[model samples]
Target: MEEDIAEIPHYKYYFATFKELEDKVDQIELLSDVIGVVTIVQDLEKSTLNSRITSCRNVTIKNVENKELQVTLWGHKTDLFDDNVLKTLEGPVVTIFTSVLVKKSLGKPRLSSTTSTLFFVNPNIPKVEDLKTRFQEDVKTIKFLPSAITTQSSLNEEKKENRKTLVKLLEIRPKSTKDMRFTVKAVIVDICEKDGWYYMACPNCMPPVSQADVSWWCQKDSFINKSPLAWYKLNTIISNQTGKMRMMIYGRVAEYLIKEPCIQLVTNHVNQDKRKFPQAIIDVIGKYKIFQIAFETKAIDNVAICKKVFDDETSEATNNRHRLSPPINPKTPDPKVSVNQR
Candidate 1:
């Protein structure tokens, strides 16, 4: 004799945003399902590194209850329908693969489906509020997936790594502007570590000279005397194998790197020793050229000079070539400042 099996009733669920569905990851079973509307569809082709390979389509669907979830279709599913399918699919019943695993990032849980996961469209799902109330009751029985929740251990590790990579200075070439053949190097001269930000000054301007505000004035006869000299802001992009990041450098740092206020050449006499200014410095301004700047990551204990130069000119040039100071000692106060009584 054959045994009779009972059929399970399909429960209706609704969600408005992706966050609502995240907590329900544990309650869903392999055969459990949901009905929702397709809200967004993005092309993943550009995300792929290779040209010859095609990528999957990432779709974000919102349930009748306004719950949002992500769906990725691979292989044949990519070409199964057009915009018409996307438009019509917004207001109906749909079966989702609940057996699929969840991927967690930054404490958020995201659903991941495999090739075996299936989806079927049904035109009869509840329209709005009615679907929402039904889902609220059903969510009570849903449990939180242990694997989906981000643990404190993982978050601590992430924070530790980020602390090490806190960028002091970033360099990038500007787009949409003419390539200023001049290479710009920004250095972080001061930092408010408490605020998680640092101050940069242009290398050319040096420190004390460039650290002026609008009120401070220069006495030079040229433009320096006519207008208030202040530090400039630089915007650029920096990237590595992991990804690209944008940074903004301001104040003294910008002035130091661009050497904006510093004149490049001096005048000399043509026949005798009379002064005749050379244009070499002016011509090199904003000219694009390649140069490298080294950043001191940590402190060095001792210095050993392998080669010694007795000539002043050669020694000065050599010193300039390796001109980087050790990290500032936080505990040491500047000796130039005199203590004032209250």
Candidate 2:
């Protein structure tokens, strides 16, 4: 097996980026093919009422732009994927999904396998190498700005808070950032676990930063540093009795809500209990909280319409921010001045 494995050659599997998929997904008929590097490949499972047994896997892929799309494969397709693309691993397995169906699942456009769908496990494609070359540059652009922003720029962003609209999750328009004020009175119904709900990042830059050659790199400050100052990117599913949506709470705010740097909880999860969720996340789940939401319809074609949350909490929800923040570190200014708590 070792001698045969070495015979496999590097291949390319190229296809559309998430943005292209998003654009053509609406036409459905026109979305004849889809492709990208699969970052995550989940396990298979079954459900009741169907003796044949339904199997599926959720896949997240990124483009040269670092834009991502979620895809799910079912039944025969899943079996095929597991047998071919997954099993044919000679090295770092690179597979490309092709001729897929674009469908709406939970309000998001996800690619799925159709009768004509095909799989290419590390085929010779130029675009694949192009993707590798561009991935780093794109990560820097999407997750962090190579150049740091001025303190004045930060102040101006804070000033825009007054002009932002205070509305609900259900009322946002596509690409309309102006006059967009909204908030949601939501209860955490479920805490999802695809990426373990939290991500490591740089504090000041809010990084989805990458590590290379045993060193941490932050495109925001263009610096290499250690792990002293870090934060999280939190993901949760929230519901306001009226509707439910996926909410991403970024660092600082997540720190404000979780009450501690998430690293502690993550460490506890890793060293103490691998199967259980961290206590901090458990505490927030099922709790009533208010979120100031931005209505960016361009995201996943209005997937649940809840995006870019500011840390503003409503008085009607709960006055928990105070308890969430530590006494040290610069005191958080009261947000009540600009927002209606309830």
Candidate 3:
């Protein structure tokens, strides 16, 4: 039996580049294999999906060309991470994820492990050694940009002393330079499709990349020849009785409102005119909800940014509570600014 096993052929791997996998994001039936240097591994987390709880972990990897991509491990795959060995390693760790399902989040192409997905950390292969050598030579220059979601969560929360109206929010200037948060009530008056629905961004830095003659150019990182990530940068015109304002919704927030991923929408409507808005986005033109907005004091083009959106149930409950509360005093300003709940 041992002699028979030794005579069997070794397993073969066919790895795909970041560009190749991104092009096949919408092909749900296709599976891909990827290999890169493990740059960041997040702590194990529990999340509910499909009405059931599951263990998941995110691992960020970069290829020899300095292109980064995120891969999520689900179920028992999360236990394959050996933290002790990773921490004690003197060199960069290279991993190969096979038979992964390519998916998109906020326009960025990511991989999710399927039932057949398998991974190897620091696998003994010539390609892995080549990746390790490249990483060692460029370790100091390989700084991954902080995720926008992470930065938004780290921002200081503002006290809900007053719910600002659309007009009031514009008039007030924050004292500090840091981002200031505010709660506001508004309705989606129109979808601003002038900038389209999404933009291609650098996978590592998250900066919007411009299309060069033959490759994508990122101002911070210069020319990156690999495939760029598509992130949701949907803009909408929101309004209240006080006034109207243009608010920017990014990434997951846009996903929450649209109930769809940007990549999927783009793929499904690839033949449609770019100027025309997709039906998924157009459906939210009349939604009335509460938005937690983040105002950047120094921003030139961006006036207001929506962080978290309250659902219909939460918005209605808050409205009811406000109507039942009596006024504190005739001289006191109205703490709650009411808007049409259509």
Candidate 4:
């Protein structure tokens, strides 16, 4: 058997770069092979799939081009990664994943392992050695920074000493049209169903896409020959005792309340009445949440966009106790606040 395998011709390999895979992120008709230097390996996680629990893990890989792509290993594939051994290995760890299908989660594209997928780490192959050499050369010129989420959270904790009421939030004027981030405590007073509950989004960039004949199209990429993903684009009125603000709760923030993927909701909603909002969305009407809102100054409309949503816990008391610091420009008006009737 070993002799027979050795006599077989060397398999012709075609590896994709991070850029190519990202551009056709919504395409899964063909499987792909990817090679990169292992930069970050996440812990094994478990989730329910088809009524059974399954294990998976994600690792961030960087190509010689210094572009990062996340590869997710599922089921038995997760065991192929020897975490302890990889941690102890010296120099850059060249890893390869074969026969992966592209999938999108929360609007970001990632490689998902199929049943035929193979995992390799530092294999005795010429391609890996060449990649390792190039990656090592590039690493010298690169300065790594902390993950964006970690950095943003640290900055928010530093500057977000107090949460603002809707009234105070409206009082502050931005220096420019650039979006300003703020944390607020508010209750969902009503769900705005004017534009329906969700949108068909481009799987790569998460922007709304329209169906153009057989293909889905968006302004960013023109026509994408891939199925668009249904993502949450919830509009609602949120209020504290001070005032109410029209807010847009998008993507995962809306998913956090709906407790289901927008794709599933879209499937069920296709035949349903178009005038009514999904029950899952309606259920959150009276719920209170701590929202990290982004105020877009360029828009003439008075709507606060929600970036992150948190559970109302001890933060509510802290919000009421402390006042929002004066705006960036003290000349900004501090208008008398009035509560809006629900």
The lDDT of each candidate is: 0.35, 0.54, 0.73, 0.72
Q: How does candidate 1 score on lDDT?
A: 0.35
Tell me the TM-score of each prediction against the true structure: 0.28, 0.37, 0.51, 0.61
Off by more than 4 A, model 1: 1-32, 43-54, 88-98, 123-342
For candidate 2, give the lDDT. 0.54
Q: Alpha-carbon error at 341 in model 4, in Å?
A: 34
Show pairs that collide, candidate 4: none
Name model 3 segments beyond 4 Å from true.
7-163, 174-177, 270-272, 300-302, 314-342
Using lDDT as the measure, the top candidate is: 3
lDDT (Cα, tens digit) per residue for candidate 2, span 1-342: 676664555533335656555544423235445555555666664421111224565666675555667666777777776633453343233457776877666766788776667777556666656665565443222111122223444433543443422234434554675446455556666666655556546533455667767776677755555453445555667765466777666654666566766667676665443335677766766556545555454664433333333333243345353223334777676877665652
lDDT of candidate 1 over 83-135, digit per residue (tens): 34544433332434434444455566556554555564543444434554545
Which tens-of-lDDT digit does each residue in 288-316 have in candidate 4? 66787777776666678887776655656
When 1 and 3 are scored with TM-score, the better candidate is 3
Residue 120 accuracy (lDDT) in model 2 = 72
